[model samples]
Target chain A: MTAGPPSLTQDEVSSSPTRCRILATAERFFREIGYQKTTVADIAKTLGMSPANVYRFFDSKKSINEAVVERLIGEVETLISRVADRPGLSASERMREIILALHRDSIERITAHPRIHEMVEAGMTESWEVCSHHVERITAVLARVIAEGKAAGEFRVADPAHAAGCIQTAILRYCHPVLIVRCPGDVAPPIDGMIDFLLGGLRAG
Target chain B: MTAGPPSLTQDEVSSSPTRCRILATAERFFREIGYQKTTVADIAKTLGMSPANVYRFFDSKKSINEAVVERLIGEVETLISRVADRPGLSASERMREIILALHRDSIERITAHPRIHEMVEAGMTESWEVCSHHVERITAVLARVIAEGKAAGEFRVADPAHAAGCIQTAILRYCHPVLIVRCPGDVAPPIDGMIDFLLGGLRAG
Candidate 1:
């Protein structure tokens, strides 16, 4: 049979608007109550659907949480990608903005809903691949900026990918959700100072 | 009063051999059964003392945990200080050794008893001062090495204290007990590469 616009697979067909509604309701419950307390029945009740219907879309609450976490990661990745591709900004400026954005995003989320950390923690424990994917995507964005800087003679790093990993790891105190919420004492240096130190590393001969 | 030999105060008198035995037993319980499960009763039972007797030394399990955490911190600080004070090594070498010692210590503790993180988590939650003091002491040791490196013209950082903070913060993934235990995926760069990057920042103009 000639391909007339490849047919939607069974998975895609089942991934309907109902799935989006379930995730939206589940995310609200996770943010408001907590990941541990939010049950599949609670999500189903909130969405005006049966628990079986919710299960048709997501096999378990853990899977639903993974989807919610994926959505949140997508938002952050999009924000960073926009910063990375912004016009008229040098690589250093872009790098600084990207780090700040990550910090601000984390702080805003925690401030807005302190229990949001519970969801993220659950994601880290139960759905590590989702968390790991976010890290890899973020590192890729940083590596892209470093590669551009190296080509433009703005940085002197030997391995942009490794340097990007170093930068991401270095700023975990500022950006990681668990850290930002748990350690509010500003144990690390201010974000600007950290970015400066990382930039110095990139610029070193 | 005459300037005679000083008398031991009540606090000093009470901090006796019994106190040391209590702490030693509590540390073992924390390591084996985990912190939350090891109550004041368990500690008292292990040391063949009444709960009230244990309380005479430490008012609560939290205080005992604080003391245990303090002792653990002391060991790490002593290790790092020795690395910092080695006579023949350059400042960079000392810094590298210090960081490696920290990583090795954390890895060893976790590898030997994964439940040890429970005690640390309790310390972070219940005895933040003990934890904060440990951070300050570690930072102080790192700052001394950085300061010496700057004076010897082996590094070019402007503020050794701030640079030391940055270095400690940068290596958290490898050193922080919670992060090391929770995220075992090696998401960050290897420790040696991370140290080289931080050293590059220090040596940069």
Candidate 2:
């Protein structure tokens, strides 16, 4: 990788250590004090930097929140991608693992860092494009597995992409942050049962 | 046809015209001014009644909201039950109609009386029991249809209740008030496609 000059472009600045530090500090503040209560100044102070310096990285708190959420969800996306690319796993097994990974990650995050939910809520409400793109990426991965399953003669779906969308939507109750928090004592079927049901759909003639 | 005396029990009072009027007026206020802003006194004033009378009917605004939500979902439960009981309709057809009705009703309510969503949100937040019971009732109706379908050799599910719960949870993205509003430009599969996919689950061996 080429070392850029001090006067870096926007993309180069994004990849710099300073940007990563700002995001990490902002995420810590969001987890500790909640997103709505945390300010850019607080993040900067925690990092021993000036507010103007932070502003140079992120124009506003909302942009900072977007970056923070992106960083958090990036971990999940990486985990899911790893599961999808695992060797010797059937499509059904991969689907199960991926769905379980998503659910487990959501539960762990919400349980371990309840305050971080505010940041996620803000991202969903204020930065919907980020959430939408995240969804599209997840759906694309699911579609790949579905297409593989169809080609393997394990699934009878005519359109892998459409079926993948349906599966993702169906599993939202188990994986969505808001739903998991809101319906703590949910009356829905367990995740395994739900997966089995959806797998039945995939394997149907 | 058994009319009670002037001193009515809680059950009898709930069926009284005055109580009905109070609920109706409260619903109107909730629709017009939103749940957080609509007070018992506002509802009482609109109905030419005392706040004490409204209190006699409903102990608090939260109670009134529970009742209002109960009444609203009562309509949906009835509609689903009717579909479940319709003559000569196959299980798949009934499921499709019920899901479509739920989606239609959600869209209509959110579109026509956007403020009414506040009351629903309040019910979900403050009176979760009412929401839980509504879910149970809907799930029960779906279970009954699934049972009938299984008996008729239309569906291949082993446990109707479990499958019903799964379907109900799966369709939440299409029917839930908060989700419909929050995901207005949702990228999920269309309702028809979702219904077909779910039917595949039910019909799969």
Q: Assess every candidate by TM-score.
A: 0.94, 0.92
- Choose the strongest candidate by TM-score: 1
lDDT per residue as tens, model 2, A1-205: 4333334578867888998999888888898889999988888898898787777778799999998888777888899999999999999999999999999999999999888778887888889888888888898888899899999999998898899899999999988887887775678888999999999999983
Clashes of 2: 0
Q: How accurate locally is residue B101 in candidate 2, as Cα lDDT from 0 to 100? A: 91
**Per-residue C-alpha lDDT of model 1 across residues B160-194, encoded as one tens digit per residue:** 98999999999999998888877856678889999
Candidate 1 TM-score over all chains jointly? 0.94
Cα deviation of A188, candidate 1, in Å: 1.4
Give lDDT tens digits, candidate 1, residues A118-203.
Answer: 99888888888888889999999999999999999999999999999999999999999888876756677888998999999999
Least well predicted 10-residue stretch by lDDT in candidate 1 chain B: B1-10
- Tens-digit lDDT track for model 2 on B1-205? 3333335587877678998998888888898889999898889898887787777777799999998999999999988888889998999999999999999999999888888878887888788888889999999999999999999999999999999999999999999987887775678889999999999999993
Candidate 2 clashing pairs, residues 3+ apart or interchain: none
DockQ of each: 0.60, 0.62
Mark the regions of model 2 whose C-alpha exceeds 4 Å error after superposition. A1-8, B1-8, B48-50
**Each model's interface RMSD (Å)?**
1.3, 1.3
